[model samples]
Target: MFKHAIAAVLLASANVAAPAVAQPAPAPSTAQAPLQLWRLDCGEFVIKQYGAFFSDTFQYPRGPKNIVGSCYLIRHGDRYMLWDTGLTDALVGNTFDNAAQTLRLRQSLVDQLRQIGVRPEQIELIGISHWHFDHTGQAGRFPQARLLMGRDDVELLRGTPSPDQDSTDALAHWLNGPGQIQQVSGDHDVFGDGRVVMLTTPGHTPAHYALLVRLASGPVLLTGDLYHFTEQVANRGVPPFNHNRADTLASMDRFDRIARNLGARVIIQHEPADIAKLPAFPQAAQ
Candidate 1:
């Protein structure tokens, strides 16, 4: 009986898995290339009367504020996306000025892209934060790229003429070919990997959105007119032309919460001061 028991114990010990040697995580699958972001000099427009045009309650100081028409180029692996086309290239030589502001473009977006060996055709997607003229000015340049915009804004573009409608010429390509438009209703993850996302924060327009780019350096939040200037972040100032004041306030609160949670670098696209958060043009944030 003792000998039979000893044999059973030996067999059980041999059958037991040999301590299940742990292999070193299979080398992590050659981690995907880091994402890259480029700040493009789309154009600039000086708000002649900041208080009159920007703040509905005249919260900001009274002075001419040089609001930048900033654009961004994001590269994830091989795919590329352009955010906010900025003021029209035509504004380069002839600075268009009205009672509210003066729009000017020092360099064309195409030329800027050319400097970094990126062509208009190379862009896979064009992200419009809003349908304003300044943001969609150069959108026509990339007709082949998919248009990702707010659903409400898209409806406005397709509906009858309204004050919110700009020339509509820049978006004529997408307008004519509705197939190319992606009418985003809520937060959108551009790459599915969660590297690039568009957060819907409407107020400035019916469907305005802010972009969140996850970079190796850190996350970045591109305020798509959510807060034109940094001051709006603190004061929760809503522009006089905003569609809904309550929605704007809520969006501001949400934006602040997100930035705080992610420890993100917030870049007010129109604010000249925010430009320094990223590297100068030609160079990229990776």
Candidate 2:
């Protein structure tokens, strides 16, 4: 159901006696250039219960229940970063059935990324919105990239038996890879220009996060499960199963304050309506 042989990194034992070769070194990622943002459809889930997404705060609001899994790509000069990889590419043909949600893929994430001329290896860094399986689906595809995740999430993944069955067992390989994991203390600036910043928006998990990419057109805030529904943005619906209810509400408050202050378009990653915030695939926002 998918083409994964070329996922990235095929290592082999070295031939120390092999002849010396000359090759051109890849250019550094510091070259200044305008940023380009591309949105990709990773997968979608069928939500049967409105109560499933929120706790006591939710009142069975009327709206569509289906939610999308959004994966984002950011190109800064020669540097590339992937934010919140959707459901695993291996799950392309299969269905994810569990207590939290049931996800089915429209297309593999790598295939969508390839449509825009980005190979897995081209991604210099992978920013995990949090350690949830839905967001870290293809993390194993880019083991070469430095994985920037919240310290609390790192701890979450380290414990036995993942919180959600939606995760890929192979993702553990990527997380445990040598020198690939970079546990962030809090917010991290991907570039020195402060254009791409990772905000620590915990509560959804112990230390969930949101990505803020400042493009020439405008600032875009990719809310990572801070609010699954657009109505949550207004009603402040806190998921019942979230790690900490107080923390979830606090995180929502901070998220709203930042969105209002930046005058940025807040994209509820699951809500399909927010897809219009960026140009369709093959065309970038900036």
Candidate 3:
């Protein structure tokens, strides 16, 4: 039915005749620039009892769950923007091991970027999902880039004795001086053309954000710890450590509506399954 309807529209358009009057030459086109997106592996962690970490109400079945960490590289025209920094480079060789969790990075983010011919210096903007260690770990490596993060999350980092010492230390350059930083209060159109946007969700953290990348293939939504796993989306599971329960629920509602309205391909950042939505590393989604 859909194909036939499209065919009918094409047939009707083909039947139209050109105007008899001569028209002036058209000016140079000013269409929106094209975009490209690439997903890179930052790290992975395994929780002994994933249910306890991702839910406040025992929503998920008790068992080990390996959560993957990811970082994204976006190219808008000639400029490049990086989303999230993932785990620290220090984790490349050593692993953070404990009874509750084990975290490690298989490769440094810079190394992965190099594999795809992107250098840390080439990235002009770094948009962070939130002020979490796992996400801000390697931000310092890109000191030349302007950092974009939630306003509240920036304030948290500015405060004395930050809650997450690792993140605070990693982002010290942005907090103190030298490095540029932009504290985002609401949804931010990164490139000003609306092709890329940072959706302010703010439940997992005070200023958490989900990224929306408009690719030629489709609109892709990157969930920033909004739903750790697919099951969380079904049960509306809120992590016990989330900043606000009510805010989380509201953000989830907004996220869902945006995804449905845009018919976006939603990729839960930490979910291994969602990570496979895009082409493998080194290949971009254009």
- Give the winner by TM-score: 3
Tens-digit lDDT string for candidate 3 (23-84) = 55442222567688999898999998888877899877788999899999998888999899
| RMSD value for candidate 2 | 12.0
Clashes of each: 0, 1, 0
Model 1 lDDT tens row, 67-156: 787999999888999999988787777878788887788999899999999988999999999888889888888878999999898888
| CA lDDT, candidate 1, residue 116 | 97
Ranking, lDDT, top scorer first: 3, 1, 2
TM-score against native, each model: 0.87, 0.83, 0.88
Off by over 4 Å in 1: 1-30, 164-167
> Which residue runs of candidate 3 sit more than 4 Å off their true CA positions?
1-31
Point out the worst 10-residue segment of candidate 2 by lDDT. 1-10
lDDT of each: 0.83, 0.77, 0.86
Per-residue lDDT of 1-286 in model 2, one digit per residue for the tens? Answer: 0000213333445765554454543422323587988888878887766674564656665333787888888999889988888788877888878765677987876788778778888989888887777888887778778888888878777777766545535456655547477788777877756778888888888888888888877789999888887778777777676787888888888888888998988888888899767788879887
